[model samples]
Target: MISLLKASPAGDAVSALLDCHDRIRSFTALALRLARAHDLAEPEARDAAAAVHRYFSAALPLHARDEEESILPRLRGREPALDAALAVMVREHREHEAAVGRLLAACAAVSARPAELARVAPELEAAALDLERHFDEHLAAEERVLFPALRALLRPEDHQAVLAELRARRT
Candidate 1:
C-alpha cells in the first residue's frame, strides 16, 4: 500500500518519524496478509512471520521512544491546547505497545512452527486489524497536530537536538 503521507527529505527528525510510520503501516499490512493466507507454504509463512516479528519487536519501540522521549517532551507546554493532545498521544503509545506484544507473540509462534499459523490465524488477524485501526488514528493525530506544532514551535537548534537524539537511539 502507498504511504498516507509523502516522504520528506532525509536528515529531518520529523521525516524520519514519517518514514517509520510508513514502515509500521507496511508491516501491519503484511501481518494481516500472512494471517489471511491460509494456503501459504511453510517457507513463506516462516519468512513473513520473521519479518513481522523483527520489525515490531525491535523497530517499533524505538519509534515510540523517539516520539515519547525526544519529541513530546519538547512540545509539552508550548501550547496549553496541545497538552491534552500530547497526553492522548502518550496513552495511545502505551496501548500500541501492549497490542504489539500480543501480535509479536503470535508472530513468534508462526515463526517457530509454520503449521501453527492456522491455529494462530484468528489472533494474528485480530491483532493486526486492531493495530491498523489504532495507528490510523494515532498517526493521523501526529501528522495533523503534533508534527505541524513541532515545525512551528521548535527552533532550528531544537530540531537538530531532536534529530541527534533520534540518530543516537539507533546507534
Candidate 2:
C-alpha cells in the first residue's frame, strides 16, 4: 500500500493524504498505549514518548499545512458548500495541535516523575481519544465530500500545484 502511494502520480495526491491519515492512526495508537502505561520510566515508555513527541511536533504539523495551505484553498475555491465544513476542519487542526502541545507537556512531567504516571495518563489518553474522534469525522468529510469535489472540480494545473506544494513540505 505504501509503495503504491509513493508511486501515485500528481493527480492522485489524495492517495498520499490518505496514506498520511493511516500513519496518523498508527502513531496515535502508539502514543495512547504509552500514555496508558503504568510505568513512565521504563525504557520502552520513554522511547515511545520520544517517538510520539517527534511525530506530533514535526510530521503532524506538516500534514496540517498540506491541507491548510494546499488542499483546502483549492477545494474552497470550487465548492461553496464546503465553506462551513472547511472552517470547522481548519479550527480542528488548531485544536489538534493545541491538544498535542498539552500531551507533550504531560509526557515531559511524567518522564521526570515516573511514579506520577497515574496522574498524567488520563490527560494523555483523553487527548489521543479526542484526536481519534476528530480524525474520524474530518477524514470522512474529506474522503466522502471534499476529495471527490476537488477531484471533479480541480483543473490539471491545480492538481499539479497541490502536488508540488505537498512535495515541497516534505523536502
Candidate 3:
C-alpha cells in the first residue's frame, strides 16, 4: 500500500528503507549525545541505546537479508557488475551484525562510571561509520544500477505485486 503522503502507488518499500536511514542517522546523533553526557546511565541514554540496538538487531538484519536475497539477487541477474558489490556488501552486513553485538553489550554495561560507555563509544563510532558507509554505497548502487535495471525488466504491475508481497511479509 502507498503512504497517504504519496499521490501515486510507488514502491512503499523504498520509502520504508529511507525511513530506516533517517532513524539510523538520528540514533547515531543520539549516540554522540550519550557519549558527551556525564551520566551515561541516565534513562534517556539507556532508552536511546536500546532503540538503536533493537533496530540493528531486528529490523536492520532482516532488511539486509531481504535486500540481499530478494532484491540483490534479482538485480544481479540483470547487471553482472553487481556481483562484486553484492559480495562485498554481504560481508559488510556480517560486520554490521558483529558491531551491533558489541554496541549492545556496551549499552548493557553502561553505568555512572567512566569505563562503561568509554569502551562502547569507540566500537560504536566504528560500527556507525561502517553502517553509514555500507548504507550509502548500497543505496548508490541500487539507484545507479539495480532500480534502473529493474525499471526495464519488471513491468509496473510486477513492481506493485512485488511490493505488496514484501509489505505482506514485513507486516
Candidate 4:
C-alpha cells in the first residue's frame, strides 16, 4: 500500500489534495450505487450519504485552506505571473464550497426518502463530475507549474515544512 502511494505522482504535498479527490470519487460512486440499488430510505442510502458527508466535511476545508493559504501563496511568491491562475483557483474553491453545500442539503432532504434519489441523483452526479474536472485541470496546472515553483523557491526543509503543516492541521 505504501509502495503504491509512493509510486503515484500525487504523493507528498500534493497528497492531501488528491486524496480528497479520491475520497470524493469513492463516496460519490457508492452513494450513486446505493441510490440505484435500494430506495433512499434504506440503510444503505443513509450509509452512503453519511460516509460522503463525513469525508467531504473533513477533507474539503483542509484541502482548500491548504491550497489557498499555503501552497498557492508559495507558488505566487515564486512566480508573480501565476497570480491570475491562483486567483482563478481561489474562485473555483469558493464555487466548490457552494456546490458541496448544495449536495449536503440535498442529501439531508433525500436521506429519509431514498426514493427521491431518482430526482436527486443527477444533481449529485453532476457535482461529483464537475469537481473531478476541476481537480484534473488544477492538478495538471500545479504539476506543470506550481509544484516545480515550490521546489525551486524552497529548500528541502521549507518544502517538507509545507507538507508537515498540512498533516498537522489534519489532526
Which candidate number would show the highest TM-score if scored against the true structure? 1
Q: Which stretches of candidate 3 lie over 4 Å from their true place?
A: 1-9, 39-41, 111-119
Count clashing residue pairs per candidate: 0, 0, 0, 2
Where in model 4 is the C-alpha error above 4 Å?
A: 1-11, 28-41, 110-115
Q: Which runs of model 2 end up more than 4 angstroms from their true locations? A: 1-6, 9-11, 39-41, 110-119
The sequence of per-residue lDDT tens digits that candidate 1 reaches over residues 100-134 is 98899999999999999999999999999999999
Cα lDDT over the full model 3: 0.59
> Mind giving the per-residue lDDT tens digits that candidate 4 earns over 58-156?
766776787777777677744566777788778877877766776666566566665566777777766666656666676567557665666567666
Higher-ranked by lDDT: 1 or 3: 1
CA RMSD of all predictions = 3.7, 3.3, 4.2, 4.1
- When summed lDDT is taken over every stretch of 10 residues in candidate 4, the lowest stretch is 1-10
Instruction: At residue 74, give the lDDT of candidate 1.
Output: 92
Look at candidate 1 and tell me the lDDT of residue 44. Answer: 100
**Model 3: pairs clashing at backbone N, Cα or C within 3 Å:** none
Candidate 3 per-residue lDDT, tens place, 1-171, comes to 223223223554454545545665666566556655665556666676666666666666656766676567566655567676667667767766765676566655553333556666766667666556666776666556555556667666655654664555556
Query: lDDT for every model?
Result: 0.86, 0.74, 0.59, 0.63
lDDT of residue 115 for candidate 1: 94
All candidates: TM-score: 0.91, 0.81, 0.70, 0.73
In candidate 2, what are the lDDT values of residues 1-171, reduced to their tens digit? 124234455446676787777778888888688777764466666667767777777788888888888878777755567877778878888777767787777667655665566777888898888877777887787778767776787777777677777777776
**RMSD in angstroms, candidate 2?**
3.3
> What's the CA error at residue 81 for candidate 4, in Å?
3.4
Candidate 1 displacement at residue 96 in angstroms: 2.2
Worst 10 residues of 3 by lDDT: 1-10
